[model samples]
Target: MSEHLASIFGTEKDRVNCPFYFKIGASRPDIITPGLDSLGNPIPPKQLQQHFGDLYEDLFEELSKYGEIESLNICDNLADHMVGNVYVQFSEEEHASNAFKNLTGRFYAGRPIIVDFSPVKDFREATCRQYEENICNRGRYCNFMHLKKIGRDLRRHLFGRYRRSYRSRSRSRSRSPYRHKS
Candidate 1:
């Protein structure tokens, strides 16, 4: 298999460091179901448990073959929780990177692994760049524009509060109008 070949000819650069892990965003393992209905909706939960169990098993197996398995997480955004994304941490960084490099752009089930180094600041920025490039131009306009508007509104709101606080402090300082009586 590809894995065996990679192991035989793989370099040290293909693996993890002491603190190895990568973050996978915008994926939901919990919502995944066994099959698609006539309307393309996901099948029932019990059916998913029966069928998708093997899929989960295979995923873990693939991960274990790469290096010492530490943790594999899936983003869950049920209830009031704002579960942002999923992160898989290995014992080493190199292992994590290796897994990322190999798995990225590869498809599993119906989705592809979008591997990247963790701690990437501003995912919105990245999406904007990708949108500009017109790489994945399958959908209508993205929600980035809306989110940007929201961010601008938030900034304006914060700025208004900050200006109010600054003005209040300045007024209080001037009202004292008296130098220290030595």
Candidate 2:
């Protein structure tokens, strides 16, 4: 069962590019990746996949410096509005804002990383139910967040580091943390 789930959603060693991290980062603030420019890249297919994994891991580690991440999601939707979107949810609103500010004009894969505040608060409420069941006629074009899954190893490392303090941080509520993390 675990293997099946792992195949469906990559494991840490796999480190495939996940769309849900965009949403996790999105709930805190929407970071839309207008373009990855993967089409023009000269790298081989296998190497390209490795690059993507590195990018996802790199992104998670980079965001960690600003604050504790509650969630990190990326969107796999092909829709213009949802493509290549990465969301990082920091434990605190300030951290989100901080990340948003710093990331506003950065470049990834020779493209600009456009970061902004997303209205999404709860991911459960924002996901497409039909999509989850694999009955969505819309497929990858669904407007709702079709969160991509992360690898267990990467997921464990990204999430496990902060397990001890998650409770203490959540108790102190601040303004809606739905904004671009600077």
Candidate 3:
């Protein structure tokens, strides 16, 4: 039976780490569990994407402490096998190594996250669709991750300065009795 199992499932040595990228398996807030449904079955892909969003700055900042991140892509494809996977690319191999060491067993959102090195060296090459071209017919079922371009002004958004100013403006407007209200 052991030999039969080995034939069906490859040996543990078949799992090897990639050098440049790190793959993170994390919990989705919308899902009751990591990959399984309430009935212990696998969750569907569309439901996974509905709960997935861009990696917030808090996670980005935490990961940055280990090394400079080149790009972070969270897969939202409607494929059962590829949903909720986060790929983080580091600028240096040493940085990737450091992050892998530190984040392997860390918990996020009440679930332990699984981190492993990925074989993907270039995200652009892995993407099935081009942003500007807008020609990907695969839509939700595409195997590749479709990441939105983060603008250059990320620093501004990260610092809360934008929110502070917006709040001040709103407060001043509320103080004015003459302000038009719909």
**TM-score: which candidate is best?**
2
lDDT at position 166, candidate 1: 62
Alpha carbon deviation, residue 89, candidate 3 (Å): 1.5
lDDT of prediction 1: 0.46
Q: Scored by CA lDDT, what does every candidate get?
A: 0.46, 0.70, 0.61
lDDT of 2 at 106: 91
How do these models rank on lDDT, best leading?
A: 2, 3, 1
- Clash totals, every prediction: 11, 30, 0
- What is the Å distance of residue 4 in model 2 from its true position? 50
TM-score of each: 0.39, 0.63, 0.56
Weakest 10 consecutive residues of candidate 3 by summed lDDT: 18-27
- Is 1 or 2 the stronger prediction by TM-score? 2
lDDT of 1 by residue, 77-144 (tens): 23111122334556677888788878888876576665656552334442334444555343223322
The candidate, 1 or 2, that scores higher on lDDT is: 2
Best by lDDT: 2
Order of candidate numbers by TM-score, starting with the best: 2, 3, 1
Judge candidate 1 at residue 106 and give its lDDT. 89
